[model samples]
Target: MPARTYPALSYELYPPRGDDAEESLWATIRRLEDTRPDFVSVTYGAAGSNRETALTLLRRLLTETALKPLAHLTCVGSSRAELTDVVERLIGGGVRGILALRGDAPDGVDPSEGDLQHAEDLVRLIRHIEAPRTAQLAAGRVSVGVAAYATRHPDSPSEEHDIDVLLAKQQAGADFAITQVFFQPADYARLLTRARRAGVTIPIIPGVMPLTSTRRVEKLGSLAGIEVDASLLARLEGARSDAERRRTGVAATVELARAALDHGAPGLHLYTFNEHAAALDVLDALGLERPPEAGTVASL
Candidate 1:
């Protein structure tokens, strides 16, 4: 059969710590699963500290539910051999897709000595594994995806340079890209145009993070280099109570999702931040319910 296509809805999850965290994560997973997300992803902790936990969670999902899991793999502080071993392990575990990254350095570590600097380098390395056995070991084929910045990357001098870097990753064999979260729909529209101009044709999914609280949203925006638009900033600033801010935030996220889909974003990738209620509320507002199967969805 031809490959299926759907307006994808995906969520990102982080590795949990103890009993409470694990319970909360499962609760969130079930809540999101009810919406029939296209896929559910689990993140690797800083320096891959939770790599094993992520793997365990992937196994749990595979055995318990029908959700396809995308494990986030980072290159920081890992040698090529180390990454190859991890890839081999995931393949053996039946995981078929990865979100490759050159992760942020752990605090106080000098980044220059790391084995992988750019995500494209990781993509190139994975590509090598898919080559002939005489050249390298085959880890079976894995769908490789990379991160993109809809707004200018914090380290980039200009948006053009950022798009160029993303295009390089796509050329290096990244199958798709998931963007950093942004509040403004226009930013993603412009970024998509720039990427196409730079000749990157892969599906670019727009990342969305529901703002549960004003303070938390502001802090996240500062860290990600997203300029909370003046109008949004004003609305949040003016909200007299926490309830008002949350209401406004949900409204804003729903509006943003509508605009993104209108602009042809291939899908919506939500940063769950280990919570589901707000994200579910936003998805409901967009009229996006869960899929019958994990990754495929029926038409509205």
Candidate 2:
């Protein structure tokens, strides 16, 4: 038999907020570039917030680095026209893939939602608009990725509903999905089982991150509406110093990633949080990901 194929390794980054942060992020970007990730995703704020900053980073990545850029566009608090413009800008800037998301709507804002009500709606829109730009694309099509949930979405009534939504997105033309940050290996396995049983065929990549501190994991759990691992929290809290805490965190993350890969996850999509140390440490520890041989598929 031929050697077993592992899925691609990718990373997620967000736009930096200020000049100092921008400088720091560039340093991290350079370091991550050396890893030759299959694709590096950039997140724009909800309702097209931080649009310019995100655009600048994408443009720089295209020109300054050898990495492929996967731009993130969220459907929330923006009109159809606004979304059309953003999509055009990304296409014109040579972005070949987008991760569609139905982001959180702002509080106290009436009509805080966009014309695109769900991620599936955004998927349809992306396919429809990109139809006219096929000649400019090297692959002759856009690769649109959506988010999958291993746990119940905060607003969703049940896990089955979330799987149904994912099915709808795939039907609407999403090529793949990267799940929200999940803590347990069993979480990813359960999601894959449910999704396959529901007829969702897209390759769903597990999004892993290095939770290097008590506050980092707590904040991510709160934001993603997922439960934090209490034992991992306790371990970090009991660490003798910041360095020890990071060591514990990275070790826990390596175990999580290894288990997911062992469970047959299609790929590893790491959340870099605009910093690279812990993420790199996790990569080094797992040693599961490597550069794909030439002419092989490097991404899911």
lDDT of 2 by residue, 1-300 (tens): 556665689999999999999999999999998888899999978677688999999999999999999999988777889889889999988888899998876666444456878889888999989987777675488899999998988889999999999999999999999999888868989999999999998999999889797887999899879889899999999999989999999998888788878888877999988899999999888886576756887554
Off by more than 4 A, model 1: 1-5, 130-140, 240-242, 289-300
Whole-model lDDT per candidate: 0.83, 0.88
Candidate 2 residue-wise lDDT at 91: 90
Clash count of each predicted structure = 3, 0
Estimate the overall C-alpha local distance difference test score of candidate 1. Answer: 0.83
Error in Å for residue 176 of model 1: 0.6
Predicted structure with the largest TM-score when compared to the true one = 2
How do all models score by TM-score?
Answer: 0.90, 0.94
